[model samples]
Target: LEKKIAHQDAIERNAIEGKFGEGKRKYGLGRISARLQTTSETVIALQFLVMNLEKVLRDTFLSFFQIWKALYLFVNRKKYTLIIEK
Candidate 1:
Protein backbone atom coordinates (compact mmCIF):
# COMPACT_ATOMS: atom_id res chain seq x y z
CA LEU A 1 0.00 0.00 0.00
CA GLU A 2 2.79 2.43 0.90
CA LYS A 3 4.67 1.66 -2.30
CA LYS A 4 1.55 2.06 -4.37
CA ILE A 5 0.81 5.38 -2.75
CA ALA A 6 4.36 6.64 -3.36
CA HIS A 7 4.30 5.55 -6.99
CA GLN A 8 1.00 7.27 -7.59
CA ASP A 9 2.34 10.45 -6.04
CA ALA A 10 5.42 10.39 -8.31
CA ILE A 11 3.32 9.85 -11.40
CA GLU A 12 1.01 12.69 -10.42
CA ARG A 13 3.97 15.01 -9.93
CA ASN A 14 5.50 14.11 -13.30
CA ALA A 15 2.24 14.59 -15.11
CA ILE A 16 1.82 17.98 -13.51
CA GLU A 17 5.33 19.09 -14.47
CA GLY A 18 5.08 17.86 -18.03
CA LYS A 19 1.72 19.52 -18.56
CA PHE A 20 3.01 22.83 -17.23
CA GLY A 21 6.43 22.73 -18.96
CA GLU A 22 5.44 21.97 -22.54
CA GLY A 23 1.88 23.27 -22.48
CA LYS A 24 2.67 26.18 -24.77
CA ARG A 25 4.61 23.91 -27.09
CA LYS A 26 1.43 21.98 -27.58
CA TYR A 27 -0.82 25.05 -27.54
CA GLY A 28 1.18 26.99 -30.12
CA LEU A 29 -0.04 24.56 -32.74
CA GLY A 30 -3.56 25.02 -31.47
CA ARG A 31 -3.21 28.79 -31.61
CA ILE A 32 -2.04 28.61 -35.21
CA SER A 33 -4.90 26.34 -36.05
CA ALA A 34 -7.35 28.73 -34.42
CA ARG A 35 -5.89 31.67 -36.36
CA LEU A 36 -6.46 29.79 -39.59
CA GLN A 37 -9.97 28.94 -38.43
CA THR A 38 -9.28 25.31 -39.04
CA THR A 39 -12.09 24.34 -36.65
CA SER A 40 -14.45 25.77 -34.05
CA GLU A 41 -12.42 24.51 -31.05
CA THR A 42 -11.29 27.29 -28.71
CA VAL A 43 -8.08 25.55 -27.53
CA ILE A 44 -8.89 25.08 -23.86
CA ALA A 45 -5.38 25.98 -22.71
CA LEU A 46 -6.89 27.71 -19.68
CA GLN A 47 -8.76 24.56 -18.76
CA PHE A 48 -5.55 22.56 -18.74
CA LEU A 49 -3.96 25.25 -16.61
CA VAL A 50 -6.73 25.06 -14.06
CA MET A 51 -6.71 21.26 -14.08
CA ASN A 52 -3.05 21.05 -13.10
CA LEU A 53 -3.44 23.63 -10.36
CA GLU A 54 -6.52 21.85 -9.15
CA LYS A 55 -4.62 18.59 -8.72
CA VAL A 56 -2.28 20.13 -6.18
CA LEU A 57 -5.18 21.92 -4.50
CA ARG A 58 -7.31 18.81 -4.29
CA ASP A 59 -4.43 16.78 -2.90
CA THR A 60 -3.93 19.39 -0.20
CA PHE A 61 -7.55 19.36 0.87
CA LEU A 62 -7.64 15.60 0.95
CA SER A 63 -4.38 15.04 2.81
CA PHE A 64 -4.53 17.86 5.37
CA PHE A 65 -8.22 18.15 6.08
CA GLN A 66 -8.90 14.43 6.05
CA ILE A 67 -6.11 13.73 8.49
CA TRP A 68 -7.09 16.67 10.64
CA LYS A 69 -10.65 15.46 10.88
CA ALA A 70 -9.65 11.95 11.82
CA LEU A 71 -7.23 13.24 14.44
CA TYR A 72 -9.80 15.59 15.90
CA LEU A 73 -12.33 12.82 16.15
CA PHE A 74 -9.86 10.53 17.86
CA VAL A 75 -8.70 13.19 20.27
CA ASN A 76 -12.06 14.63 21.28
CA ARG A 77 -14.22 11.57 20.91
CA LYS A 78 -15.01 11.69 24.62
CA LYS A 79 -15.11 15.29 25.68
CA TYR A 80 -15.38 16.23 29.35
CA THR A 81 -16.25 19.58 30.87
CA LEU A 82 -14.23 20.85 33.80
CA ILE A 83 -14.73 23.88 36.00
CA ILE A 84 -11.72 26.15 36.23
CA GLU A 85 -11.12 27.90 39.56
CA LYS A 86 -8.24 30.27 40.08
Candidate 2:
Protein backbone atom coordinates (compact mmCIF):
# COMPACT_ATOMS: atom_id res chain seq x y z
CA LEU A 1 0.00 0.00 0.00
CA GLU A 2 2.80 2.39 0.81
CA LYS A 3 4.54 1.73 -2.46
CA LYS A 4 1.32 2.19 -4.38
CA ILE A 5 0.74 5.56 -2.71
CA ALA A 6 4.30 6.66 -3.49
CA HIS A 7 3.88 5.65 -7.11
CA GLN A 8 0.65 7.60 -7.42
CA ASP A 9 2.34 10.67 -5.94
CA ALA A 10 5.18 10.38 -8.42
CA ILE A 11 2.73 10.09 -11.30
CA GLU A 12 0.93 13.24 -10.14
CA ARG A 13 4.22 15.08 -9.83
CA ASN A 14 5.21 14.10 -13.34
CA ALA A 15 1.91 15.31 -14.78
CA ILE A 16 2.21 18.72 -13.07
CA GLU A 17 5.83 19.08 -14.16
CA GLY A 18 4.88 18.14 -17.72
CA LYS A 19 2.31 20.94 -17.88
CA PHE A 20 4.88 23.46 -16.67
CA GLY A 21 7.31 22.22 -19.28
CA GLU A 22 4.64 22.57 -21.93
CA GLY A 23 3.88 26.13 -20.87
CA LYS A 24 7.57 26.98 -20.99
CA ARG A 25 7.91 25.52 -24.44
CA LYS A 26 4.71 26.86 -25.99
CA TYR A 27 3.81 30.01 -24.04
CA GLY A 28 7.19 31.46 -23.09
CA LEU A 29 6.59 30.85 -19.38
CA GLY A 30 10.32 30.46 -18.80
CA ARG A 31 11.20 33.95 -20.02
CA ILE A 32 9.00 36.22 -17.93
CA SER A 33 10.39 39.76 -18.18
CA ALA A 34 8.52 41.21 -15.20
CA ARG A 35 10.82 42.76 -12.61
CA LEU A 36 8.33 42.73 -9.69
CA GLN A 37 7.29 39.67 -7.71
CA THR A 38 3.55 40.23 -8.18
CA THR A 39 3.96 40.95 -11.87
CA SER A 40 5.96 37.79 -12.39
CA GLU A 41 3.40 35.76 -10.56
CA THR A 42 0.64 37.25 -12.65
CA VAL A 43 2.57 36.54 -15.82
CA ILE A 44 3.01 32.90 -14.86
CA ALA A 45 -0.68 32.58 -13.97
CA LEU A 46 -1.76 34.07 -17.29
CA GLN A 47 0.57 31.78 -19.19
CA PHE A 48 -1.00 28.73 -17.54
CA LEU A 49 -4.48 30.06 -18.27
CA VAL A 50 -3.62 30.59 -21.93
CA MET A 51 -2.14 27.10 -22.15
CA ASN A 52 -5.32 25.54 -20.75
CA LEU A 53 -7.58 27.63 -22.98
CA GLU A 54 -5.59 26.72 -26.05
CA LYS A 55 -5.90 23.03 -25.21
CA VAL A 56 -9.67 23.36 -24.87
CA LEU A 57 -9.95 25.27 -28.13
CA ARG A 58 -7.76 22.79 -29.98
CA ASP A 59 -9.81 19.83 -28.75
CA THR A 60 -13.03 21.54 -29.79
CA PHE A 61 -11.73 22.26 -33.27
CA LEU A 62 -10.52 18.67 -33.68
CA SER A 63 -13.89 17.29 -32.64
CA PHE A 64 -15.65 19.61 -35.04
CA PHE A 65 -13.38 18.49 -37.85
CA GLN A 66 -14.09 14.85 -37.08
CA ILE A 67 -17.83 15.43 -37.23
CA TRP A 68 -17.53 17.29 -40.50
CA LYS A 69 -15.41 14.50 -41.98
CA ALA A 70 -17.95 11.86 -40.96
CA LEU A 71 -20.75 13.88 -42.49
CA TYR A 72 -18.84 14.33 -45.73
CA LEU A 73 -18.10 10.62 -45.99
CA PHE A 74 -21.70 9.70 -45.34
CA VAL A 75 -22.97 12.05 -48.02
CA ASN A 76 -20.39 10.88 -50.56
CA ARG A 77 -21.19 7.22 -49.89
CA LYS A 78 -24.89 7.87 -50.48
CA LYS A 79 -24.12 9.65 -53.72
CA TYR A 80 -21.98 6.76 -54.98
CA THR A 81 -24.65 4.21 -54.13
CA LEU A 82 -27.26 6.20 -56.01
CA ILE A 83 -24.97 6.42 -59.03
CA ILE A 84 -24.35 2.68 -58.98
CA GLU A 85 -28.08 1.92 -58.78
CA LYS A 86 -28.91 4.20 -61.75
Candidate 2 residue lDDT tens string, 1-86: 99999999999999999988988898998889999999999999888888889989999999999999989988888665644453
The TM-scores of all predictions, comma-separated, are 0.36, 0.82
Clashes of each: 0, 0
Q: Once superposed on the true structure, which residue ranges of model 2 sit more than 4 Å away at CA?
A: 79-86
* lDDT on C-alpha atoms for all candidate structures: 0.69, 0.91
TM-score of 2: 0.82
Most lDDT-accurate candidate: 2
**Model 1 lDDT at residue 26:** 53
Lowest summed-lDDT stretch of 10 residues in model 1?
29-38
- Best TM-score goes to which candidate? 2
